[model samples]
Target: MNTEPEQVSLNDLAGLPSMATLVLTVNNRHARRILADLSAMLDAQRQVMALPDIMPVSAWLRQAGDQWSFASDNGLAAHTVDAFGALSLWRQVIIEAETDHALLDVGNAASLAQEADRLLSEWQLEVPPALQTDEYRRFMVWRKAYRQRLHDMDAEDGVLGFERVYQAIVDGKLHFDFQNLVLVGFNEYSPRLRGVIDALRAQGVAIFALQPSQVDAAQVERVQAADPDTEWRLAARWAQSCLRANPEGRYAIVAARLENDVALAHRVLREALGADGTAPAVPYNIAVARPLADWPLVRAALCWLRVLRAFLLHGRCEPSLAGAALLSGGCAAHVVEAPAGEQMWLT
Candidate 1:
C-alpha cells in the first residue's frame, strides 16, 4: 500500500465521481470561490456534469451531525443546540448573573465566554482553579450557571455535539453514504475533528488530503507600493487589465485588511474599471461583511421598532432627538419629531 498525499489541481474537480465527497476550506466564502473556479475550469473544458458532494468544513460538520442524529437510536438530536442557540443561552446566564451586580457589555461578555468555553473543549483543557482575578471569578460563576442551565435544558452546544457525533461514528451508529472523501485547503484539524476522520478511515472509507501544487517562480509576481492606497490602486489596475485581456474570464482581487479599507478599494476599483460615474453595474464584487446592526436600514428599522414598543408600553415615544432624526431619515413620514426643548407626547 502506498502512503502519499494526493496532489490534485482545481481542474481535477471536474472529474470527481457522483458518489465522492469533497470537503473544502473552513471558510464558506473560500469554498464558494473554489467551487466557482472549478465550475469555470469545467466549463472551459466543455464538461457539463453534476458535481459531487461539495461543501465547506462547517457545512460538512453540520451535515454529518444531522446524519448522525437521524441514524442514531437515541433522541440526541433534540438535545443539541447550534452555535447561535448556545450563545443565546450564555447571554441568558450572564443576564441572570447581572441581577446581583452590574456587568459591562453583556453581549460582548457572553460572546467571549462562549468562545473561551469552545476553545477549552476543543483543546481538551480543564478550567484552571485558583483564578484570583475579579473577571475570572465572575466568568467562573457565569460558566457554572451556564452549565447548570444546559443541564436543565438537556442541551449540548456545538463542541459537545461534535464529540457525540464522533462517538456515534466510532460505535457504528453513524454512517456516511460516500466511500471516498477529499479534503481541500485544510491546514490542520482539532483533536475531536481528527478523531472523527480517523474513525471514518477505520470504517473502510478512503480519505485523501488534496495538496495544492506549487506555483512556478516565473509566474509569480511581487509588487511593493508606497502605501495601502497605492497598493489597492495598482491591484485595481491589474484586475482591469486582466478583464480587458480576457473579457470572458473570471478574476478576483484580494486585498489585505479589506474590512478596514473596503470603501477606498471600492472607489479605486470602480474608477479603474471605468464604472465610477456610470449607472451600469460594476464588474467586480467585494466580500467584506459587516454586522447586521451596522447597516443604516437595519438600524433605522430597529430604532422605529423600539420607538413603537415604547409608545405601546407607556403611551409615549421618548426617543432622543438623534433617534428621531434617524427615524425621519429612514421613513418617508416622520414617526417621532422632537423639536428643541420640547416634550412630544403620543396618546
Candidate 2:
C-alpha cells in the first residue's frame, strides 16, 4: 500500500498531458458513450465479479430463487441495482428477511445470526447463516449448488469481461498513458476501481474527482418541497446554470439514480430557467428511464395482442378496454378477415 497522501489536484502530475480518460461503472456506459465517442470501456460490473464472494447478491438470489421458489418471508420486492451501495444493502435485507421467516428458530436467533456473520467475516468466508433452523439448511443446500453454476459462468465470461482490466493491472499489463484522469459526477467507486485508480496515481497519473455542486440549505429545502429527491434536481439546476453561463457548454447525466427524477428535473429546470417559457429543453445526453409502454408503437402492439388473445379465447371482443388500448388506431387495422372470407373479425 502507498503511504503518500492522495493527490487531490490534477496539477500534481507535472508534464502529463491534460487530456483525460473518464472511467465509469457499467450503468454509466451510456453517459461515457456521450462523453467519449472513441474511448474504450471495461464494464466495471464484470470486473468486480473477479471476487466470487462479492459477485452481486442479486445474481445469487436470482439463480437461487429460480431453482427453488423460496419466496421472501415478507415479500421482499426485487429492484434494480443502480447504485454502488445497494449491493451490501440488498445482502443485509435478504439476510434479515430470511431471519424473519416463521419457520426459522426464534430463540436467540438474532444473536446467533450476528455471531455467525462475525465468525464468517473473521474467517474471510462468504456464507452467513441468518437462523439456526431447517430453513437455513435448505438455503445452504441451494446456495452451494447455485454458487457452482455461477462460478462456471464467471469462468466462461471472465476473460473478456471487466475482470480482465483488474487482472491486467495486477499482472502489470495494464497502464495508463495519459497524465490526468478526471472522474465526473461519480458518487462512489468500487474497491477494485479504487485499487486501479490508486495504481494509476502511483504511476504519476493525476486523478481529479468531480462532483455536482450543491445548492444552499435554504434553496435545498425549497427545491425538496417542489421535489423531494434533491440530488438529481440540484444536478439539473447546475447543468441549467452551466448552459446559461456558457452557451457552448454541454451537460451529461451519467448513471443517474431514479430515472424518473432525471426527466422530471430536466423539465422543471428548463421551464424555470428559460425566458418566457420558450427556452431550449435540457440536453439529456444519456438514455434515461422512460416507460416503454408510453410509446405509440408499443401501445399499438400490446392492444393488438390483447384483442387477438381475447377474441381467440372468449370468442368475443371486450370493446371498452380493447378500444382504449387501440386509442386512435382504428379497429379496422386490427380486424382480420375470417377463414370463410364472407366476414371479418379482429384476429
Candidate 3:
C-alpha cells in the first residue's frame, strides 16, 4: 500500500518494513518540501527512532564512492553517447545475416567494428557458428586490443563507467550501511537500476517503492484554423492575455513539444513586446529542459572570451570563435573581421 503524505508521520515511520534508508526520486523543489515536512513531524514527536538517512538516488551513488565530482570521478557522462552508439552498433551486427555486407552500409565503420569487438568480450555470449566468418575474425583482433586498454585504465583508477558501477553493486563490491531501503516516487527504472534493486533484495534488505501516478487530462481546441507559422505566436498571445487578466492565478501552456514550442513562445512573446524585449510581468514555470549547453547568453560570453584571449596572445582569432559568439548572440548577419593589431585589455 502506498503511504499518503499526511499519514506518514515520524511516529508512524517506525512501523514501516524498512526505515533505515529512504531514497526519494523527487525534483529539487518537491524534495525541499518533503524534507521540511519530515523535520516538522520529528520535532512534534520530540523523539527519534532509527532516523533514516534520506537522500536522492544520485546523491546516494556519489556517497557510496565517497566522491562528489560527477565529471572527474565518473566517465558516465562523457561515455553516455558512446555507450548508446555501442548498443546501436551491436543491434546491427547481431541482427544482420551477412556481417560484412551490413558493415558496408554503416556510416562509421570503425566505430561499429570497435563496438562489435567490445560486445564479444563484455557481453559474455557464446559465439554462434553464423558469426564465425572472415569479417568477424578481422574485427576480433581490434576488440582484443581495446579490451586491454580498458583493463589497463581500470588498474590505473580511471573514472568508473556507468555499467561498471551497476555491475559493482550487483557483485556486492559496493554497498551502503543501510540495512533496509525505501524508494519514493520511482515509477520507472532502467535495466541497470533494476539489477541493483534485485541485488539489494537478495541481501535480505527490505525494499519498498512508493510511486504516485500523475496524469494530465487538460485539452486544447484551436478557435481558429491551424496556420503553422502563426499558431504558436497566437497561443503565446492568448497565454499572455490570460496571465495579464488574472495576475494572481497560475496558468500552464501545454504543447506537444514543450522543449521546442516553449522556447519559441518565449522568443515570440519577447519580440512582440518591443526592443526592450519585455513580456507580460507574469511568473512562468516552463516544464521543459534547459540544458546548460543550450544557454545562448553564457555560450556567447564564453566564445567572446576565447576570441579575446586568442587575439591577445596570437595576434589573430579563429573564425569559429567569432562565428559562435555572433550565432549565440543572434547577430550572425553582422559578423565582421577582427581589426588588425587591436589589443584588448581587461582590468
Q: How many clashes in each structure?
A: 0, 2, 0
Per-residue lDDT of candidate 1, residues 49-147 (tens digit): 677767787677777777766653745734877776787679778977889787767768989999988786666665457746787778778888998
What TM-score does candidate 1 get on C-alpha atoms?
Answer: 0.70
TM-score of 2: 0.35
Every candidate's CA RMSD: 5.7, 15.2, 10.6
Instruction: Encode model 3's per-residue lDDT on 1-347: one tens digit a residue.
Output: 43212223333444554445564553555456545555666554565544456677665654654432232434333222244344433333443434445444442655576555545434444668786887667566545544444454442111234355656678776655566665655556645556777887767666665444356768746577367448767766776777667767766656777765666767765654333345445556656777664587676766676677778767897686676675555344433523221222111
- Higher lDDT: candidate 1 or 2? 1
Q: Which lDDT tens digits does candidate 2 get at residues 94-185? A: 44455545534332343344344334322334545564577467545434433343344332121122333444454454554456555544
Cα shift from native, residue 23, model 1 (Å): 4.3
**Where's the lowest-lDDT run of ten residues in candidate 3?**
338-347
Candidate 3 Cα deviation (angstroms), residue 63: 2.1
lDDT of 1 at 167: 77
Clashing pairs in 2: 47-162, 47-163
Per-model CA lDDT versus the true structure = 0.72, 0.45, 0.54
TM-score head-to-head 1 vs 3, winner = 1
Question: Could you tell me how far off, in angstroms, the CA of residue 69 lies in candidate 1 after the best superposition?
Answer: 2.9
